[model samples]
Target: MDKANADFTPIFDGQTLAGWHAVPRLPVSRAPGGPEPDRTTETYRRAAQTTGSWTVEDGALTGRQDPPGCGYGGYLLSDGVYGDFELLFEACPDWPADTGILVRASALGSQGYQILLDHRRSGNIGGIYGNGIGGFHGINFTIDAEYDEQGRPIGLRLEDPATTIEPMTPDKTALLNDAASGEQFLSIWRWNEWNEFQIRVEGALPKITVHINGVKMTEIDTAAMKHPSYRQDEVLALLGPQGHIAFEVHDNDPGMGDARWGPNAACRWRNIRIREL
Candidate 1:
């Protein structure tokens, strides 16, 4: 990728990667209660155990597939945490893989908001995960009981869970909005090809804007998003200042025997970059 006409200045150019350190890879299987590995070794170990495959080449990061027992592929880091910043990166998955850009992550716990990148046929892409929440795939709404002039339940309603919930279509453009109100900020699609992702984080009010080949897809209201048994404020607080970014690859095919151990099923990431807003 060329550096010309770049919106965000290049912080760590691929030519001479400075301030970025290469984390080592570690063994997948370890005996119970074994002596813990060194820092770099442990980082690689945790990544392999969690995401399945990740590698670096020519100063660019890439993810690949390894057997389930070889460790899950992803990044496990003790660095790269920011608050109220903008993150820009390019991701292209070879197969159906779920990748994410995480911010304000907790160093000691799995508590934070993740901008998901999933390519499944289902409309589950570009949602928040973790921080005591499992999944909030798309914009969902619930309407309180309507009241008439006599304070009785009215017949008219809008955007209700029983009948008003709908998924926003994908558009390739930037969007901005006040998080307090549930507004359509962005539309996202898991394109078959590479797409540029722009994530703007303004403290607890994080917004996600996605574009594909210069076409606007979607903008999501991070603060207004809600899920069952989870509070947005609590998750944001736990994210703290900084944390590691990772990718998640899971075995979805259940027909094949030992599908988890099968080959030809893995995810990859490239051209990763972040700019502090």
Candidate 2:
């Protein structure tokens, strides 16, 4: 394989997690228990008896959740913090899963810019979302300003008044897509197919830009975005210019009788390499 010319570095060792840590899927409890279990056992307990695992297979960093777990998604975070960098990786999902590349995350939580990988029917492959920022938190994405009937952005700092967001065209130098469902955009992405994702983070508050299979999706000037749920000060705090990189291991919703966490959602990530700019 060719190198990124020494600017980029490979983080995953293809077989082990030497410099990574897994955050507790759920908060620690003071429940009545027998002789505080070991850290690993405590984690499974925190996961509400459901086992979500991150491991290396086929030279990739893979995260899996089984038993439709009882906790929220957990992150496998890097031990070090990063700021002003470009990250590239490939992700493949086999089912309806919510996956993200977390950059500039705060400590152990999802406080940062997320490259949303909600590859379901109505999900987007390349989009900027604020993690743990109220209205933006936990939702697929954030929307503050309303759109006109023609999808023209009503109010945004960087948007032009004449054009709507839809029908957006990238530079002719980039690849093209045909639909919003992500699958119709190109053959590069599909269930179980490896889709290359590239993310760039810059500026003091960080302007997030995303690309999938070499096509630009959209960009978010974090400091300039407005939303009803969170104030700019609140949102600004969540955008960590220096933080860890992580892969989210999703938790299954425990429901029964057709309301289950079924349809089995799972994703795989590989070739996770990054370079600071």
Candidate 3:
């Protein structure tokens, strides 16, 4: 049974890569400027040149890539699995970079649910993305805002309208279009600065909610809908009970050899904490 208690604990020590593992990664088909897959965990650890990189600096957990855009970005997997819990962290991404948090994420190449971290004009931040299954299953739920240390709004972060090319239901696609024009979301996003990120997931596919700066951005109820593939339930089942939490450095051919891994590919995270409810 799931508990309702809230006792958060630190996971990363901020000094080492303990309790984390790097999964082997390579570029997807037809992507250029990306390296080949390392083939094994050991091989990934031993390679002089890493397609993706992870490090601890200034007490922050950082994941980085090079040459931006070209292929698939790398992933860092947790040593443990979690379900029906809340996660808190700070993420700062360089514009043009791609990143996200994977829940019940599988090491088998994007097989899980993702919380988008792309803050670009064509990206969806604080949105639902289907890993290995495809792209966004739902439209973005939060608006971007820029604030200062004093908790005052400085400005708003906005993404330009993007053409929909992913396989999505007509209704959902329309929803995305409407959302892009709606000022329903508030932006608290800051460039090259730390931003608070929180996620509350509970009740199996019961309820998943995402927040930025304590603002509710997106929510999903698994029982209310199903993926068209007829495997979303099965996949969620595989994730539930318990599954790994992960961070992704995305690498894909956005267009014309533009790498998902951009020049400022160093995405930093810190103050990791989690607790089961």
User: In order, what lDDT does every prediction score?
Assistant: 0.43, 0.58, 0.62
TM-score of 2: 0.68
- For residue 184, model 3's alpha carbon misses the true position, in angstroms, by 5.2
Lowest summed-lDDT stretch of 10 residues in model 1?
171-180
Misplaced by over 4 Å in model 3 are 1-6, 26-51, 66-72, 134-136, 141-157, 160-170, 173-186, 254-256
lDDT tens digits, residue span 142-180, model 3: 233356899644555553335423322454433221232
Worst 10 residues of 2 by lDDT: 171-180
Best TM-score goes to which candidate?
3
Alpha-carbon lDDT of model 2: 0.58
Q: Candidate 3 lDDT (Cα, whole model)?
A: 0.62
Give candidate 1 regions above 4 Å deviation: 1-51, 57-59, 68-71, 76-78, 108-110, 139-192, 241-243, 250-262
**Which candidate would rank higher by lDDT, 1 or 3?**
3
List, residue by residue over 42-144, the lDDT tens digit for candidate 2.
Answer: 5556565433677788877776664444334577899878888888888876444666777887775456667777543233456655565532422212212
Candidate 2: the clashing residue pairs are none
Which of the numbered candidates is closest to the native, going by highest lDDT? Answer: 3
Q: Which ten residues in a row have the lowest lDDT in candidate 3?
A: 26-35
Q: lDDT tens digits, residues 95-132, model 1?
A: 33434545554553233556655432221334444432
